[model samples]
Target chain A: MERTAFQIDARDNVATALTELAPGPVRLAGDGEAEQVEAVEPIPRGHKLAVKFIAEGADVVKYGVPIGVATADIMPGSWVHLHVMRSAYDERSAHLNLRTGAPEDTRYE
Target chain B: MSRKEIPSLEELRALRWRGYAREGGGIGVRNCVLVIYTVKCAEFVARGIVEGCQSPDVQLVGFDGCTDSQCAVNLLAGLIRHPNVGAVLAVGLGCEYVQPERLAEIAARAGKPARWLFIQNEGGTLPAVERGTAWARELLDELRNTPRVPMGLSDLTVGAECGGSDFTSGLAGNVAVGRFFDLLVDSGGTAIFEEIVEAVGLDWLLLSRAANDRARAELRHAYDKMIAYCRSVGQFSVSPGNFAGGLSTIEEKSMGAIAKSGSRPIQGVVKISVPPPEPGLWLLDSTPDPNPVQYGITNPNDSEGLMDLISCGAHVVLLVTGRGSVIGSPVAPCLKITGNAETFRRMSGDLDFDASPSLTGELRQDEVARLLAELIAETAAGKPTKAEALGHREFHIPYKYQEKEARRADCERR
Candidate 1:
């Protein structure tokens, strides 16, 4: 299949889904082992997916630096989001919704 | 990690453009005679001159304050001395604290022809408009003869700002701008990045990039002040809507937001209305002035951000938006770039360049960066940006209490 995800760096453990990715052979921008990671679940556009296995408590790198850490062990192609990962520096990450980008705690009058 | 494709100084210095050389040691891509209204009552008169003038280069800007907001005056003064502007026509009711002469004097001091009048002194609208229009037409005509000098990246000062961002913004648009900024700085040009409030949860990241110890101290002070301002205002820069675009955390979002600054060591922090003292990478802090009585909110909108960038003497401003933006500003031309291919296709008429090709791996980030820099060169050499070509010259100067010392940028209050 055509490439639908992008990885910023070779060290990046996650690749951003450029579109709504269904369970299939998802190809990343570059080629290599795990470059053709399978989508373990449906991932929304702009959300992240594990390009390789991410063990619990390990850094999830993007742009060649740690953006967050895996909350649980994540296999190749599994969606990487708030459920399975958390921000290393920002506590507010836990409240964000993946699809809408709206914080769960936001309230309006 | 694989090697990135950044353009070198040799490549940057190779390009050149013809620009209007300013008297005080700078250059202008445009040569417009700006009409400035000092008070709210004079707006119609000032705008009348802009409209009645035959030359399209006659631009209008104003402050609506009846009382003195040093911040407002400073910004107006900065605009008068902007490199894009060649002359000035200052109009007022003569009651506002922003003296019409004071504004016109700025243009004169910058070696540009300037004139001023008061609506009250002129006995009303028609007389002021007729006189002002005649002066503006003549100035714009004579400015057409402003000597054009050869300029390169070293003579340029470009400002970067982003809004309405999405995942593609960080991955493509901002990343490309960052790379472009790096090249601009390496080639002896000045690059100023705003929305410093967006650099949340990354004080270390910001401080680490400071070019010198003085810059480190300035960054610390600006960051602490911004954080304090955020706390007092009870707002962080992030919003619920940011998540809808796929930012996962404040740091995650900030990491993407700040990518436009590139990897150059930050020169130092400067305030609104204050141009960077020298050419380099500078971070503009838009936090409000610490006053006992705060009257207005910060960064009322994105147009204000672009205006602030202009007031600080950016020859052209690159506004990166993943979602997209159509607005522009007076004085300097605004270049809107986006990384969302769909948005680019939909708003191609308004957007200047599309960095979205990088997102699909069709183009490398640095390749897009070079292309964007080339666009800047073209715009500097008299090619109007989409915003300028579309005549989207919107501006805003709210009455905020900032010391004349110049706290720059348009960081939002909420």
Candidate 2:
């Protein structure tokens, strides 16, 4: 597969979108399998696009680390809008699910 | 049994510092003759003087500060004290907040020959230019008589900066620079980075990194102001490129941006003109203006970003970018490093370092860090960076009030 998306770290589950992505038919690099996306959200260029299905409260990864948590259920190729994600540092209301390895208590809490 | 920890300070320093190393005073690459304008009004006069004298070793630079007399005075004094500056010349509008006479006194106390040209006393621009040029010649002659002595690595203050960023910035370039910045700080040299707008989301993380409670509180206050200023601007702290690159919140963007600092203990926090007294990670309190929408260009961005860090007396600036920039400063040498391999290839002519391999996992983090340290030392030794070769002389915009702070802070009280 041609390398298109950026793999920031070997540990990262998502690859950052360096170019504007098209919907409907797409395949993730390295995965080697053709997978479809919901386009439930439109990911812009320079934004992160999920390479695999993420749970409702899973850690949304970027730069090969957990950047934030999902506010709603998400799928591969969905746009991670601001509304659906809360800040890992500044946002107060993000519930850290201990089972999923999120911080149990945030400063705002 | 536990694995051995990372290399000790002495080992790391020996591995990195080459044969040309010294203790006590930090090492610097270039010995610069810093000609600083005490106020914005005196800028043209100072430029004229430097241009007229035109010595190969001399360079002209100034600040956008004038409103706060005290801040301006402190900033100019610090610039004259900067180790890279072998000599100093301060020019001013006679009645400006920072008096050129006071600056001269400070420089003289520091054992550097200081002189000034005042526009009001010297008749006008042309006359002042003539007098200023003559004074500069005398000052350079005095500086020439002053002996050039050997210096050390600890004498260096490297200010890190980034602009025109993309996702690759935080991951590759910023992180690589951060590792080097950590090393620079550990070596007892000062490493400074600014742009309150870019610091928007990572305040709390920074606070946590603070070595003490006082540092943490200062970081909190500065960061809150930064966020409040960003909110006033209406556009989210995260830029369009950040959002497009998949960062959803200011914190997310900040997490990546702040990564350039690497893993270092926050020693303290400071205002724009104040540099860290000793060596440790420090934050420059850079909040956006209250009404960025009204002012259009109130906050820190490319070119102008150099002023904030430089104002604090940075000897050189490390400018990292994913989208390439061509500009550099007249005072401090700018080392331009790019993160994107393709972007670096496309714009290799303008960049100094290529950080793409770090992102691609081809280069170990420490190797890249060592390379950056070597480049920094080389640039300080008068090795021209891409910016210097191209002659990029960017200036800063003066501060202007745009909105009521109370109202601006109310929207995102979070």
Candidate 3:
């Protein structure tokens, strides 16, 4: 069965997977000529997968805007979430709790 | 998304509805008699009045602070002058800086039916509740005949704020809003988008969307101030849920968040409690004043953000949440739209519209926006939103420092 992912912009090097994507050819729901990309790993729903190769320190484009920069080299069909990318503006984003998304040192009084 | 389709000018301008007309200016989607307590001390009496009335037409909101802050005063004044408030009753405990008579004077000047009394002077709670209830009922009965006027898209001011965002929020929820904003702006309607703190790391992209040089400069100043404020506070408005929902950073969230403003050229930056000078697409910057002593409050929560939008004279407020939220503002009718289809289905009772059809490429962005516009029209025609039906008339008026000291000085000198 064909899986789907959305490339928000034609300039985007990544697409947000609409469902858990296994290693296979996935259809594109966004604007791109290739129409599809082969997923090499499992991509979680709402998480991103690179639609094109991204070199280290390169910007990760989405919504036609650079959301962050690649921490290391990334290839097409690979997961493009926090590990591969980090925000330039906010260094604390990397420290957020995986489950609750809570930031470090957050205490309720 | 090919080139994201947008609604034509005709579809936007086609909306026409009737609403109560405020004599001062603007149209009211709901005419509720608001009983406002000037300080925390008067809360019981004011709330008692609203409860005794047992009518939804009468509403209650109050300031819990004893100290004087221009931001709080202006926010209250904005609510009073709001087209939705048919009449206002100001209640105060004699010691507070915000006097009940003064609040009444402000409302009366705005051509609203106004009344005032101090909890101290009215022999405390017993007589106060009795007298305030009588006054509220009289105003409610009198306000029933408020003249209705034909209001169209051009005559409307719509504001949008996003909360509980996920990946779909940007791809669908906010995208729908952006397309609708374009439609609204093209038709000469005013669209105000707030949460300047969320516009992180995209200053150039933001400034480039300005309508002119003046607007560009304004956006720059506001953006810089917000960045400094965020750095000082050490928070970027991104939440844990946002992370769990697949958002990576403030930058990624900002990219999605700003999409609610659509592709329209922003008119300029507007401040809290200040309405848009004219209108096209104005950005509300509620960031606190950049002073050494006070960073001030921008958005404490989704409800405060919604109130900030409502204070700017919005007739209808759109709340786009990727993770479902059931919040509603007191003055303006909040139309809740979700971008996640599963969240929409699970929380169907609370959420109003779904933009998720665009997420699967099942529907065009412009088409979803037209359907959303119909809901706006129905809401303007007095159709209560799910929030309204649930009686979620939430409000927040936290004290914040603004550059209104000079204005306050002028008021004192008068």
State the RMSD for candidate 1.
Answer: 4.4
When sorted by TM-score, best at the front, the candidate numbers are 3, 1, 2
lDDT of 1 by residue, A62-102 (tens): 76777778889999888887788876655665767766656
lDDT of 3 by residue, B272-353 (tens): 7788879699998877765545635578888888887888889899999988999887878899999998999999999999
lDDT by residue (tens digit), candidate 3, A69-106: 99999999998877788888877877776545777766
For each candidate, give its TM-score against the true structure: 0.88, 0.77, 0.93
> Which candidate gets the maximum lDDT versus the true structure?
3
As for lDDT, the candidate ahead, 1 or 2, is 1
The fnat of each candidate, in order, is 0.52, 0.39, 0.78
Clashing pairs in 3: A101-B240
Best by TM-score: 3
User: Which stretches of model 3 miss by more than 4 angstroms?
Assistant: A107-109, B1-12, B404-414
Give the per-residue lDDT digits (tens) of candidate 2, residues B1-414.
012233444554553322212122433344556677867788888888877986655677765566543433544565566655656777888776666777777767766777776788989899998987787787677655444444434667778778767777876789888998888887887777765555654566677788898877766766776665555554444454555445566655666678787788877766655667777777665443333233444354666567667656677898888877887876678888877777788888888888766655567667677777777766766678887776666665455432212124433433
Model 1 DockQ reads 0.44
Task: Report lDDT (CA) for all predictions.
Answer: 0.82, 0.64, 0.85
* TM-score of predicted structure 1: 0.88
lDDT of 1 at B322: 82
> Once superposed on the true structure, which residue ranges of model 1 sit more than 4 Å away at CA?
A1-3, A10-13, A30-33, A50-61, A64-98, A101-109, B1-12, B403-414
